[model samples]
Every structure is written in C-alpha cells, then in structure tokens.
Target: MKKTFGLLNEEEQELLNQLVEGMTKEQLLWTSGYLAGKSEKDKKTIKKERPDMPNIQVLYGTHSGNSEVISEKLLQSAKNNGLDMKISLMEKFEYRNTPLLQNLIIIVSTHGEGEPPSNAMGFLDFLRDKDTPEMPGLHFAVLGLGDSTYANFSQAGVDFHKALKKLKAQPIMPVRKCDAEFMPEAQKWMDQIINHFSGTSVVLRPEKADIPAGGPVLNGVANAGFTVPSFKRVYDRNNPFYARILKKKLLNGDGSDKEVYHFELSIRDSGFTYQPGDTLSIVGDNPPSLVEAILDKFSFGRDEEVVLDKQMFTLYHALRNYLEITVINPVILDRYNRFAGSKELTDLINDPVQLADYLYGSDVLDLLTDFPAKLNAQELVSVLRKLPPRKYSIASSFDAHPGEAHITVAAVRFEKKERIREGAISTFVVDRVKEGDRIPVFVQNKKKFKMPEDKSIPIIMIGPGTGIAPFRAFIQQRKHDGIKKGTWLFFGDQHEKTDFLYGDEWNKLKAEGYLQKLDLAFSRDQDEKIYVQHRLLQKSEKVWKWLQKGASIYVCGDKKKMATDVHLALLDIVRNEGKMDINTAKQYLNSLASDNRYQKDVY
Candidate 1:
C-alpha cells in the first residue's frame, strides 16, 4: 500500500488522478483505514498532520479581465500549498448561496466609476439588496483592485467587505485594496493569504470530474500546456494582430502648435467590428531611438537573446516590442537602484520624496542618462514591466466608414527643462512609421459610452479639442440613420483659424442641415477666454427644453476641467431653470445616468 501510494502520489499523478478525481480528505481518511488497517487514532493523527488543508473558494467579481487573472493565480497558489479550492467568476457563482460557502476568498475589481464589473453586476446587486444571505459560518477575505486616481477608489471592495461583515461573515484578513500598479502589493497580499491557510486538512474535488484531458484549459498554462478553462482566449498581449494602417493625415493646421493626427485603419479582413463609441486598443512599440539610447548608455549588446513569457527575443527587440521603457514607475526605479553605478542616483532612489519627484518629472530615458549601469539582456527584460496597450476613441461609424476605422489622436511631444520627451505610442505612429505599415491593434468595447437607440431622441454634445473625436462618429451615425431629432454641438479650441479640427466637414454638415446647431468658442480668438461650458450655459433654455423632451446629453473632453465644468453647467441649468436645490439637481443627474440619458467619454 505504501509503494502504491508512492507511485500514485507523484505531483502530476496526484493532481490528475487523485485531487481532481473526486478524492476528498474525508474519503482519503476512510480509504486509508480500509487499505492499510490504520487505527482510528492513526487516521486522526494523519488528519492533524495535514491540518493546513483548508477549503478555499474564490469568487471573482469583475467585468474586465483582471479578476480572472487574479483568481487563476490564487487557485494555483492554493493548489501548490495542498489546499482544496474552487474558483468561479462572479457571474457563475450565486450570491444567494453565500451562506453555504464555509471557507472562501473573494478577489474583485471595480469597473467604471466605483461600480461592480459587468460580469459581477448581478452578484453585486443581489448582495446589496435586502435579500442577501447571512453567512455567520463563512470565513472570508476580500482583495479589491482599482485605480486610486478615480473618485471611487476600490469602492466595490469596501462595500463588499462591509456587507459581508454586516451579514456576520468572519473576516480572516483585512481587505487589501490594490491600485493601478498592483502587482507587487498583490503578490505580497497573496503570500499573506497562503501563509494564513497553512496546515489545513479540508480537501476540494474538481467541479467536473469526467471532463476530458484535451479540453481547452483555462487561466494560465500549467504542466506543459494543460491549462484550466479560464485561459482559452486566443488574443492577448502575447499574441496580437498586426493590423494594417489604411490612412494617416494631420488633423491640425501646418501653423498650429498642437500636432494631432487623424488615423484610419483597415479592419475589413481582420474580423474586427466596432460600434460608433467603442475604443481601439493599439499594442505599440517603444521608440526605437529611446530603446537604443538606453542600451548604449549601459554598453549592452543589442543582439543578445533574452527570454520573456517563455519566448526568446533579442535585447533590442524585447525592449522595443515587449517591455515598457517610457513610463518611470516606482517599481522600475527600485529595480534599477541596486544596479546603479552612481552613488547620487542610488541615494535618490532611497529617498521617498526624491523618488516621487523623479518618477513624476522624468521618463525612462532620463534615468539611464542620469545613472548609467551595466545589465545583461535578460536581466534588463526581467526588470522592465510588460508593455500595455494604448486605447483611443474610435472616431468612425461602421455604417458610415464601412471597412475603415478612424481615430483622432494628439501626437504628444513636450519639452521639460530643454529635454524633449515624446509619448511612446503617439510618436511611434506619427514620426517613426510610414504609410502601409502594420501596427498591432484590437477593439476594446465601451458598452456604457453609447448613444441612445431611439432615433427620435435629441443629443447635446460638448467636446473641446480632440475630444471632438467621438462626436464626429455620433453625428455621422445620426445622419446615416436619418434621425430627425435635434443635434446641438458645442465645440471649442485655441483659435478658429488654426485650431478647428474637421472644420470643413462641420461646415458642410451645417450647410446640409445635418448639424442643426454649431457653437464655437475659440479661447485665444478673443481677449476673454471662452469654452464649451460657456456655450452650454448660453444655450441653457434650449438645453433644458431638450432635456425635458427626454433628450440625451453627452460630454467628451479633458476630465480635469472641461468635463467637470460642463457637468457643473448642466447641474446649474437644471437647478436655476428646472427649479431644484443642489441635492435635488444631483439626484436628477443620477437619474440620467441610470436611465442612460447622460453619457460621457472624457479622458
């Protein structure tokens, strides 16, 4: 029996034939007694030795793919520690069954502005409702991921934690709220969770016992491509399509200070389809010049091969294609500090204020120039973060643009203390790549940012500068559908002569009565600066009337001032004209959000 156990208990054999084949801890204990004639005390002793075997069920509530990734990692960690676990996406798990969950862990990420992710919406709604179950016996921990910059930072996580506590579920650990750059903190939190569950005897059987071996595995690939069901998606950062650039033209005038490009890509044959308000995600390369400069400073050979994500590429290629070399985050600084040849740079990294100053004020190239260090190809790749895709508002309608997709982008180039800094992706598109070049791109659907389906509904648009991108698509869509409802556009720029984007198109549309009203407020055109918000306020009576008629309002522009100002103006319009107090006006706005009457694509 010992020889049999040894033969069958090899890691893979145990995982495949025992752990996943309905072998529970209690069943194993009973079987041990039958097979080896173990006394009851001996079986109890065996259970005591494996006391770390806690049953963990991870319920991930997320709309984006982040929670799925986190859940997969958590499941793997639990398996490595010999804990029986069940992981389910929030949509698959029933919130009403919370009372039945004995030992559980929840990893949820917030979506939109402090709302539950799309997949977790139903679960979150049920939990928030009065009918939620009382889970007095449940021992649970929650980890929330969000961006701290947003007003509702990890709000979903906080809400879930509070709700669980109210329902009498024991909190095994304090809720961990991770920010946009969450990997380091998340890894540490995961380590703590694994340590807390050390030495448990509970065992979990696989959800499906009779599934075939060759089925599509999910999550990350484990044990030679034997992945779980969660990792079946074919498109990701590792494998991206090389999309062809169909058209590229300058949006700004020749004399204009701002350089904005209007790019069009051909997705006709790529099986990519997008609505008017969706976003196009481009997987771009780091500027080759900057990549070369960093390598030259360290005297690193460009041709040396480095392995990343199990795939090998040359040092220069990896830096350009796979690694992030533009942003100077704290993690990158910490990694570089140890290898810095300069004492001053090392000291600066140790100082929190100095580190913050450096990260904010400098780019990746700035670090290499300030403190040169020696690094091999693979070591450098290990230190750098994975390059993330850049998202742009799709500026074309499928009905209007047909096979082509358009985007309005400002080529980011700025000077700080006489050193020129260029945005990695923007500069790559504008200055580096020529026409007919293939750039890897994908569509990121924005379900919330959409026009009303009703053709008779009116729309009020306030978009300044390149924020006018999506409105162009909106107008074209309305025209294509022959919508007779009123369409009012309030657009602003620096100067009418040099700053107006799509000037000719707007003029033609206005002439054709497609654009019912066009209000322009060029800030630099006069001594007194005016903007889209001022125009919005000026048209308050008409706007209020339109709103009363169930018209939808949309704002697309800079989030810092323009969007906020426009939002305030709308509130004021409703307050003064509609006759409501401040709180009442806020409620009115919330009603619009719920009813899908107020939509924004500001960034």
Candidate 2:
C-alpha cells in the first residue's frame, strides 16, 4: 500500500491516524461538507446553446419516495447537459399524450410481488389497457427499482419495457433493474442515458467513505468502511454495537406448530434510539454446524487465516461473521460455477427457470454438497457477499420502554432432503441467543411507515404473525401518551392459544380503554382458515365508515401474500359498501395511499 503521508514523522502520522479513525462516517461526511462549503465560490458558467436537442420527459412512480428521488435527480442531471427536459409524477401524467412525447424516460418501483407502486397505478392501468396508444417511433427507456430478495424483483420495470415495445415504441436503451442497494446502479443507468443523448460518457462521483476504527498508521489516508449515511456514532452493520440481551421469552404455548419469541435488548447507554416502524437490525453469525459443514465439504482447515477489511481472522470466524452462508442468490452461484468449471452447474445456471427453482430451495451449503467443489479459503471468500444484517421491526416504542428495544422473531426449522434447513438469522437469534448474551445491533428507520401526527385520529391495523411488531409499538406509545384515539387491531396467527403475541399487554390496554377494538383471527383454531383480511371483510361496513371519517389504515406482513390478500379484500369492501365499481374502488384505495392515509411495511 502507498504511504498515506509521504513526509510526515512517525508520531505525527500516528496522531493523524488516531484522529481520523476516531471519527464516524457521519462525522467524516459532515467535515468534508464543511470543508467543501468553505472552498466554494459562486461562479457563473457560459453555455453554448444548441436548440436542436430533443425534448425529454422523466416520469416516476414511487412507493416509498425512492423512485421519485431518483427521477428528479436524473431530471436535474439532464438539465446540466442542456437536454431540454421536464419531470412529471406518474399519477399526474396524462396517459393520452404519453405516446406524443418526444423522448420518454420512466422510472418506477414495484412493491408487493410485481405490482406497480401506488403512485404508478393509474399509469400502469393506462399502459396495459387496450385503448392505449401505439406509437411506432416513440423512443423510450425504463428503469425499475426493487429489492432482489422479493419475488418479481424489478418485474415492474421489465414489464414496462416489454409493454412499450408491444405498443411499437422504439427502445433507446434496455430496461435496467436496480437492486435494493440501488443508488449506484441507478446512476449508471442515468450515465447511459446521458452518453446516448449527448454522445459523451461521464461517471457519477462516488461518495467518500468514513474511516474504520483500526489503522496500521502507514500514512494519512485511513482504512475505511463501505459507504453509508454519515451521522452519529451508534453501532451499525459496518461497525456493529454489541447490545446485551435483557429478556427472552417464547410467545407460543405448548403443541404449537411455530416458535416465536419477544426479545428485549439493552441499549441504555449505547446512544441508540429507535421509533415505531424502525427495524432492529441484527448482525448474526452463521451457526457453528453450518460453518463446520462447509469446512468439511471443502476439506479446508477451520483455523486458516484470511484478511478482510485489512483485518485478519480465522476461517471459521470469517465464514460465521462475514460471509453469507445461507440463501443462494444467482450472482453467487454464477461466480461459484465459474470457479468450479462444472458443465452441469453451468448449464443449470444458464436456464433461468431452473436457476430460479434451485436458488429458491437451496443455500451456499447446497452448492458444496451437490457439486463437491474444492476451493481454498481466499477463493471461497471472493465469491461471497458480506452477511448483511437481518432487520426485524422494532416491537417496542422508545416512549414506552425508554432505554430498551424489542424484537419479535420466529425460528425457522424445516427439513429438506433428509437434512435440516434453517433461516440464517432467524434460527441464530431465536433458538441460540441467551438472556445475558450480547449481540450486534443497529437501527434502520422506515420513514414512510410512521404514525399519523394527529393523536386523536383513528388507525386500523392489520398484521398477522410477526407483522404485529410495529403495531405493538403503536399501542405502547398510545398507552404511554394516553392518547384517546380510536385504535383497531386485526391480529391473526395459526392458533390463538400459542401465537397471540403480546396478548397480556393488549388486554391491559383494553382494560385501560386505550384499545378501542381488538379483532382476532386464528387460522388453524377453526376448521376453515381465517386471516386478518377476513376480519377486515367482516367489518367492511364499519371499515367504510372509518374511511369516511378520514381514518388511516396500516398493513404490515408478507408483501406477496398477506398484504396482497388484504389489499384485494379492501378493494372488495370498498366496492360493495361505497357503491362503487371495481375500478373506482381500486382508485379510491390508491388515493388513500397517495394521501399517506394507507401505509404498509410489508417485506
């Protein structure tokens, strides 16, 4: 490595190293911003205007504001290059004139399976309708944003690209899908657009990173961690703050088909604070058994040392703490197959359907067990993305608990092909963690999923299984503040006896008159499967009345299944009770979302 400081003395270098190392990412960014601001001078640049550039429009459909932000940034970048442009929200755009536009660039995000975001609902309907226009020479590009872990990842963008082509629109660029970690990828797509339009290639500037704690004091530049929003010194994925587990109790009773627990972590003086809808991100290690199995399969010694982030660790520690051992994504498999050079593995990955099927039911261990490939420690490490933290909704309110953060986790233990398979973080936290044990934790804020500011306003909550987490925080906050708001919770699980999580606390809330309504749906307790959406349907008349009274509704659970089902049930309710047709009812619900009266935190 090049020396950070070429001429600095030993003591001076050490002092500078300590100073940089001690600062957090947030602090570093703040300092850099300060320095840049001080160095800036207001100056005007003369531009050579060319009036012949084609006019462009950037349209966006966003659920949690990500797509909107990206689209706006792109619009600004376009203006910088003098590519006459305008920006429009998907909901507000006139569908009839879309085909008449000169150059169209649509950026949309998908949530809950392959569905377009609420803001884009109208746009989606217009595009897919048979009455929509067919423009033979309309040039366009599409960018889709979604988390890769979700089903139909970037499906909305892919669908848009195909639909535009079907409508005879010419593609200026291929549809690009950005993963959950999307900003960088989104910038790349923008770069492609700029290059095509202006015939000039440019790159987005990378965000400067924060210096990690440890350093060899070689020079001035310190070893740094990955990019993140720089701010306070609370422990995070890059620098996990170890928190002591204060309490651990299984919420399920005997003979239950599932295992769920409510756990509390002590963050009293760690300078960590969380609000409702925030997630308690746990950085869990791989189970020893799984780590050992991988070692056995590769015939690699567990004690072998490897370097990561300029730090050394044993192979076992690296595999457990750093590498993603469970969950096999296509990227990892593709890289692994390249290393293995197995024709069978290569062929399987080449088939999209087969690859998806294999990835869905398999893990990293599955690759080793099935292919039996031999790889050295460094080679194995190169193929692995870091084990990202598992984010569980914060089940307690800071207002209610003061210094503690709680989480509701369900253990994953299932049998597959004569061997037991487990969810990486789920099993690690639920089954293995002890009361006094310390675990790494950080807080992830869910800005869109927040309580209404009006305390007296009513909230209808539908959360089944562990999705009841944030609602727990809501009820706790209400009870603590003594807000007289009318609150309704529709909770469901397999059996009422076992999975009625936080039942005692809820009962107390009811007794104290803080809970206005409590609806329960136990799917297995009755002969027919009943869920929270069923409860919503049963109370359809009242639900419509609540909507009339300007009540906000919140849904949290499985995005593809529960959230979708609940949304359909809601649409049905609106259609029947509001005396509206299916289309109107759907629009009504979409309007609620647009108004921020309908919020969801499903994953």
Candidate 3:
C-alpha cells in the first residue's frame, strides 16, 4: 500500500481508507474510477471559465463483445449530444507507446480470474511499462464491466485505473461498476457525463440511494428514478423467447460410452434467426433438490423471505431461479469461511495452489457439506452470485432450417463422494427438459468465425466431438449456397460406428462433391489411439498445399488439449512441408490469426 500521509491530506486519506476497507481489489478499482470522475467534477466546477469543447477519446476492452457494445452506445450518445469524440478498440489502439489524451473514458471488462480480455493484453503491457508517459494534464473517467461470480471481478479495469493514477492522471469521476444488467446504470453514468460537461452539478438519483438488494418488486413501483432500457426488433438475453423443442435424439449409438445429443428447437414466428458461426445462449436454473439440500444445511425454511437488488422472493425461489450454487471461487469462499470461522479453510485460502485446487472441484454444496456456515437467508444470498447463462455453438444453418435451431450437447455425469454429480445445464437438459418443452434462448453473432466471402476459396475445419457443431452449420450453408469450394474436415472420436456425428450428412455431401476431403481418426478403432492432430501430421503435405492455395482454417473444440495439439500440428506442417524453422512457422500462423483468416470457437 502507498503511504497515505504523503499522497493525500489527513481527511482525504481517512475517507480513502474507509471506502476501501474490506473491499476486494476489483471493488477498489471501481471505487478509484468513481472517485476520479467525482474529484474532477468538483475541481472544475469552481472554475469561472470552462474548458474548450471536449474531444473525448473513448477506449473499449471487451470479451464476448459486451464492452464494445457499451463503448459504441456511448460514442453514439456523444454524437447525438453534439460532442466531438472518437472510439478505438484496445487491440487496435497504438500500443508501441502510452497515449496521452486530454480527456479520456475507458470502458473495459475483465474475464477469467482478473485478467484483461484477449484484445487488451498488449495495450495493458504498454501501460504497465516503466517508460510510460505521465498524464498531468489528462482528465479521465473509468467504467468497469464484469460478472460478480468470478474472484477477480473487473480486475483489468482496476489495473488500468491504478496505472493511470500512478502516472498522475486526474479523475473526472469515480470508477463505476455494473453487473450483466448494465444498461440502466450505464445510461445514468452517461447522463452524469453530459451534466458534468454542461457545468451542471450531478443529481443524486432516488433509486440509486434507496433501492434495496435483489431487484425492485415485480410491480416496479420502488424503482422510481431508473429508466429500464427497451429494444425494438426482437428478443435478446434480457428478454429471451421460449422456443419449443422439436427433437432431442442421441447422436451416439447404444453402448457408445459417450452420450452426445442433437437437439432441434422450433423458433417459428419468434423472429430468432442465427448464422452458422453464431452461438445459442440458454439461461439455466439451479436444481430444486440441490437448493433444498443447501436450505436444509442452513436450517432455513423455504418460505423465508429474502431480498435481492430491490426485489423480494421466497428463499426457495431465489435459490432455484436466480443464484449460482455450482462453483465456489475465492471471493465467495472467503466470505463463507469468514462466516463459518473455519481455520482449515482459512489456511487453504491463504495458499494459492491449494485454493485453486479446492475451487476447481468444490461447489457451494461441497463447501456447505464440508464446513457448514450459519448465515441467515439474506447473508447467504448476498455471498452467492447470480447464475450466468451458458453458450453453445449452433449446429444448424438458417438457410436449411429457417424456423429451427440446432445444438449438440454432451452430458457431463460423474461420481463424487459416492454420489452422482452432474453439470447444471447438461443434466438439466438430458433429464428434465422434454421433447415438447420450451427453453429460453437468444442468438449471439460470431462475425469473425464466419465463412469466407470468396466461394472458391478452400477451407479446412478441425472439429472433434461436439466441436463439430458449428462445422455442420458451415457445410450445410455451403451446400445450400451451392459453393463448390474444396472443404477438408478432420474429425475424430472414440469409435467409428458410434461416435461419428453427422455421419450420414458428410457422406451425402461427399457424394455431391461439396466435400473434397474427409479424414477420420477413430482412436479405439485400431490398436494405437489416434486423434485429429496425428491425422493432420499424416496429411502434412496436403494441409500445407491447401494453406499455400489460400485456404482458411477453423478450429472448434476443447482448448486444453485439442486446440493446443492442432495448433502445434499446424506449426509442424509449416516447418516440414514449407521448409521453414519452428519460429518462422509460428510467426506464419500468427499472421493468419492476425488477419482473421484463422479463427477459433473453443470452450
């Protein structure tokens, strides 16, 4: 920690310490950003003459495109308000040196465990460098976007805020944070910006001050000062449409050891359309049995009233429909351990390696069953995070089935502590959801993962198991579009007869000459187990030739092993077939990635 006395006056230091006491690093970052804006507004409000027209430089760091959406909205709002401003994505921002701007606004989202989004890595490195430029004249505001479930929520924003503060950048306002339901909060912050520039004092909205946790009551009478955002065309994540399931059939034959399913949902008249590279997001709820078990552990009744955000719900309803209970991260665990006062958990939390191991396998149920805590209904609800939605690659093309959407799912069932433990969504679909049942869903665009515009260009797809979902859509769309481009697919699974997903479709496509190559690597079919990576090595010369002829590559599947192995295989192919060294081959693949000719959609 910095020396409080040297940095600020006694009064200011006391306020800072009080605001940050018990806050996580991510929360502190949000506080810093919020303070920057408030401080700048206070400092400039007393000035007799206002500065010249604001030329704002807005920067966005995003994962899954949320931050970019927020940035664009702000940019459009600035234009509408007659403000001169420009926005740049963090990856595209010139990162060779630190940028010095007079007025800036940063909208960044953190992903994983407090790491910057993929696009912001290089830009963050530049800011962290010792030789970064000072910003004495710069006035800035920060707004962090992130999920509260993860341990390092909004961590990237915190890093940037701290770095800029060290360089002497003055804050225009304090760092503000918003959860997934960010539009209302974002709109309020935008209004504050407009008022600040107009030399108007910020108004303390009533709802911001008075609304309780959970959410406002269903009637929405208590949320007086907040304006709920609306959409024009169709449903989205905020308002998903219930699409009925037309079919749910297992792709793997009997006795296959794997249980992969192919589902077709009827989107007829819902206005929900999807592209080949898009994803279908489904919001899942906690299992009632699990929720009841936790309630039993706490000795809490189902009828107990619990509040969240400003809305009220019964303890049972909230646990089943809203809160996440499957995973326990560091932040949530710390709070639980504190409540339980368990020295063992406290010791484990202090050690980084052991804490990670515990978090990996331990869910809320595990935590409670092992070291029970005696938190009230309200306190228990407060410690847990809202359940986030699950995303799956859409396996059907709208061109072929305009009124339907398809997805492939692999059921995750395992034995834990002599009891069956199933994945939240995977098992929910397999066991509970019926053929005629309706599921809430929304489509997410994957523009970069789409097909090439030039129909004649050859394409190579490496999708093993459920990763083949999107590739099925691509090939279907190609057949529908009558594109005669050479398509090569490398698919692998356990056994040839049982695990070959979309087997009939590939055969039909090949017969029609739409597919030029179909390579299969069924590991258990022969003595030695083989995978797609090994198959790629066997076809090294052919793979290199396709790349030489301007073939684009797509990889979709497991990131841990398959993605890494396929990437290595590409490097090896480039080295041996192209007669280049390992480093040169690596650079060549990187160039393809930079140009968006190579794309990935792995989970």
Candidate 4:
C-alpha cells in the first residue's frame, strides 16, 4: 500500500495503521476533520491570495491555561471575521520558519519570578540566541498576562516583544499587559486585532455605566465576564457554584507553630468533577474587621453606591465581597498614588526593591494609613482590583470520594509594621466559614501536573508542608485504582509529632505495602534543619535507578525555597549518579521535563 500510494514511509504507514486500528467511528471522524482543517491551514500558509489579508497565526505560552484561553478567543474571533488563523503552542513553533510567517499574535503569561512559562522557554531561548536570524517581514502583536504583585509583571511577554523588535519584526500594536482582571482588556485587544485584519475601523461607544443582570460593570462598560457551561448549568469566576462545606478539621497539633486545616466540600449535583491534580478556587470575602478598619480610616460611607462590573453595590458590600482589600500590589499602589498624590509612594513604585519591601505583609488599610488619601468610596473602590479566587491544590481524588472535593490550607499569619496580618482566604476559611456554609467555588484543572496515564510507571513525589496536598490526592487515586506498588513519597514539616500532616494515613499505607518507600524529614526534629531535598540527596542511588526505569517525578510546595532547593538537588543527583557533567545532566533533566516526566505545582 505504501509503494502504491507513493506517500508514507514504512514506519509512518505502520504508525498510522496502529493508530487507526483501535479507533472508534467517532474518533476516526474527528481525526479526519482535524486533518482537513490542518490541510486548509497549510494551503492558506503557502498560497497567499490577498496581500492585505496576510496569513496570521497565534502562539501562546501558559502556566495556568489563561494564555491558551485568550488565544482560542482570538482564533474564534478571526474565524468569525472571515480570516484564516492557526494557533499553536510557542514550544511547537520552529524557529527556522520565523522568516516565513506573515502575522503572529502572541499571548503568553509569565511564570515563577520573571521566567517564561515552561512551554515558552525553548522558543524564548531561540529568540534570544545570537545565532537566530532576523525576521524583518514578521508583523506581530503581544498580549501579556500576569499578577502585578510580582516584581516582573508581564515579563515574559515583555521579553518576547523586545526580542522580536531586536530581530526587526514590525509590530502591529504595542504590547498590552493585563493584570488578573484581564478579561475586558483581553477582549478589547482581540477586537483591535480582528478589526485590523478585517480592514474595518473600530467603533467607539460613549462611556455610560449601567447595571447588568449578568454581573457588575466598571468605567461605563461590562467587564466582559463570561461563564463556562457545565453539564446542567454554567459556572466560572463570575458565576461560581456555592459548595457547602461537608467537614473541616485542624491537621496541626496543639503545640505546632503552624495552623493547617483539611476541608471537605460537597459538590454533589453541582456538575463539578475534577481529577487528582486539579485545584479548587474559593471565593472568599475580606475579613470584616479589616473592612471596617478601612471604612473607618477613610471615613467613607458604607452605604455609598460604587460601580463594579457595571453593577451598583453598596460600598460596604463591595469592599467585603467584590474587591481586593487585604493585599496590596504595585498596580494598586500606582492607582492609589494617583488619588493620594504621594511622592514617596511614587518613588517606591519606581524602585523594584523598595516596592517589594513595602508590599510585603501590607494591606489596603496600611496603604490608607501611610498615604492618608482623601478619596471617596467610589475612588477607593476603583483603585482596588477585583477579588481573585484563591486556588488550592485539591487534596482528595474524586474516584476515592465521589460528589466531594477536599483541600488543605495553611493559615498565613504574620506580624509586620507592628501589626498582625493574615491571608484573606486562609483567614476567611479558618475563622469565618463554618461547616454546612456554602462557599462560592470553582475547579481549575492543572494540565501540566497530571499523573502519567501509564499506571505501571514508577512515580516519586516530593512535597513538604502544605505542598503535600496534591500528593495526598495522588495516593488516594492510586489506592482507588488498586495499583500502588511503585510509589515513593518524601514529606517533611517542622516537626514529626505536631506538623506531620496525614501521618496516620501514611503509616497505614506503608503497613499495607501500597507505599513502596516513605521518607520523612522533620526540619526541627534534629540539630540541623533537613528538608525534602536532603532526603532526595540521601536516596540518590535509588532515585537514579527509578529515573533510569522511567519514573515520573512530581514536586509540589513553596516555590521560593523548597521547590528551588529540590530542583537543585535533582540536578546534583543526575550529575553524580548518572556520571554526567553539569551541562549534560541539566540537559537530561530538561529532557525529562519536555517528556512531562518532571512536574511541579508550586505557589
């Protein structure tokens, strides 16, 4: 058949045969449609019939899937406007084809610190390298997504834009950087690009605020909020399911320095189903004390009407439920300074180090106290960002406990500037919420941190402190599947007696021979502090063997310290045990990451 067709090679023919051998009729139909779409896209790329309507493509890099979502929206908008557009992952784009592209739209999110998302690293490296040729013909636009709290806000997108400019690519529009409340801005950016490609002028409407039934609005326009449809209903950040708490228990002992709680929520009949690696996003209100303090400090009327998402809400309710108040970021600081006109605050905003120092452990009340702005309720509310949902690693598997979701939360309490402060959501869950109370909730699927589908593959999990949340779900999932012979876990905390979360469960699993290897590191149990990284180093030989046998490694925990330490330890292990040099070992680890054998879900 290969010779008769004069097309596919022997290996390709064999692969195609194997692929189609077990495919159902529906699968075959879907595959045919996908191929046809690809063929049409290829034809458009090669045959440019119109000079004005250049072939356009979208490339995205995402950590939380937001970039991909925006890219999809752009693709749909282009299609609606009778334009041909192909969308791809940044990692999948070949650098060699850079000069061939006509128009490129990049939607990317910055990952930890200032780094590009994992998928964008390769493409970013290619762009930064000296060997890469210039692409004078490429016209592009970039949209960046990030939290303004980070020092390097929208840094990945900034880097891409800068690199493309250095390579002499013409830009269709200046890069747009959006904060967590990115929907309205993202929609506008998409509309601009669609209009540009369709040769249509943008229509500007008059600014007029009106309440909408869907949600609130700000600045005389809807927030462009939308809902995702589920089995029976739609839900999203704008419209979330109110899940009743089934149970809540403090996991820490009396003498423990930390306060950790395990919560189980009933999602029964809510049309929410999640896998082990998914996250549960909780919409929590600001602490009443903090809200009252802010109102008192500003002497603002609680009953004053304020606009949010185009809907009018009482200032009290807006501060309590709809806006962020407990934390401060550069974006908020900049906005507030506009009202306060504080020169000192302006200086701090311009200095990254000073800004970081000021932002740490600070809240809205702190901002008000320091600046002493004479702003009204509406002005104050306008300065604050929307209340983003707090997402936690799901701690229980749906297979193990149907119609329920579980999460582990560690209360964040600290003393700063001679004032006691706490995390908004953590404190809300621990202090304000009671069992049977319905909390607004949604599920965020983490595609990058999923377990390998091949259950027989050996797996090593390294999670310490609250990072152990998803690992618990992984174990529960393995137990439910009744295939847990090749599992290894390294967990640590401050002390084994008080802070060893789920100690009894681990012991039971160990005794039952389901948990093949269990390593514990209690940082304060000994003279010197030891973490999961130390444990990983101690088991270097076995770890190397597991890696050789194709084991997947999962790390979940604090990104600033634990995740960094564990990553370095893994590199050292590969260098020492694999008998390779530093660069080669680094490459080996990169290969593992590329294959999805190494995954991290750190905050």
Candidate 4 displacement at residue 185 in angstroms: 2.4
Candidate 3 structure, TM-score to reference: 0.78
lDDT (10s digit) by residue, model 3, range 405-492:
9999898777677755666677666766778766667787754577788878889999999999999998998889887568999999
User: Tens digit of lDDT per residue, candidate 1, span 1-603?
Assistant: 233454464555655565446778888877777766643333112221224334677888764456777778777878877867888887777554556567778888876567666556566677667755566777888999976435566888887888788878899998998866455467677777777887542322222111212211112121134322333234433344445577889977768889988898876655567777787877666776778887787778888888975666778777876677877666676677667657797787678677666676466778767776776667777777766667788888889988778988888877775767778778777876655666666676665678888777888888899889888999899889887458888899998888899999989888887889899999988899998889888989988999999988887878768888888999999999999999999889877865768877766
Q: Please give, for residues 387-447, the per-residue lDDT of candidate 4 as tens digits.
A: 7778899999999999999999999889888878878789878887778666678787776
User: For model 2, how does the per-residue alpha-carbon lDDT over 1-603 read when each residue is reduced to its tens digit?
Assistant: 435567776677997688779798999999889879776432222121225333787888876666876777777677777777777888788666675576889898887768777678777777778866676657899999976655478888988888888888889988998875566678888888987888765443335323223221111112133233235564544455656688998999998888998899887766887778788888676666888898887788898988875677788877876677777776777778767888998888788788777877577788877775767898888777667668788999998898899999998878777878888788777766677666667776655688888888889989999999999999888888888568999999998888888888888888788888999999999789999889999999999999899989999988769998999999999999999999999889988998879998888
All candidates: CA RMSD in angstroms? Answer: 16.1, 17.7, 15.1, 9.1
- Quick one: ranking by TM-score, best first? 4, 3, 2, 1
Task: Output the TM-score of candidate 2.
Answer: 0.72
Q: lDDT scores for all predictions?
A: 0.73, 0.78, 0.76, 0.83
Q: Largest TM-score belongs to which candidate? A: 4
List the lowest-lDDT window of 10 residues for candidate 3: 214-223
- Tell me model 4's lDDT, rounded to 2 decimals: 0.83
Q: Compute each candidate's TM-score over C-alphas.
A: 0.69, 0.72, 0.78, 0.86
Q: Could you give the candidate ranking by lDDT, starting with the highest?
A: 4, 2, 3, 1
Best of the two (3, 4) by lDDT? 4
Checking candidate 2 for backbone clashes, the offending pairs are 4-220, 5-220, 26-230, 26-231
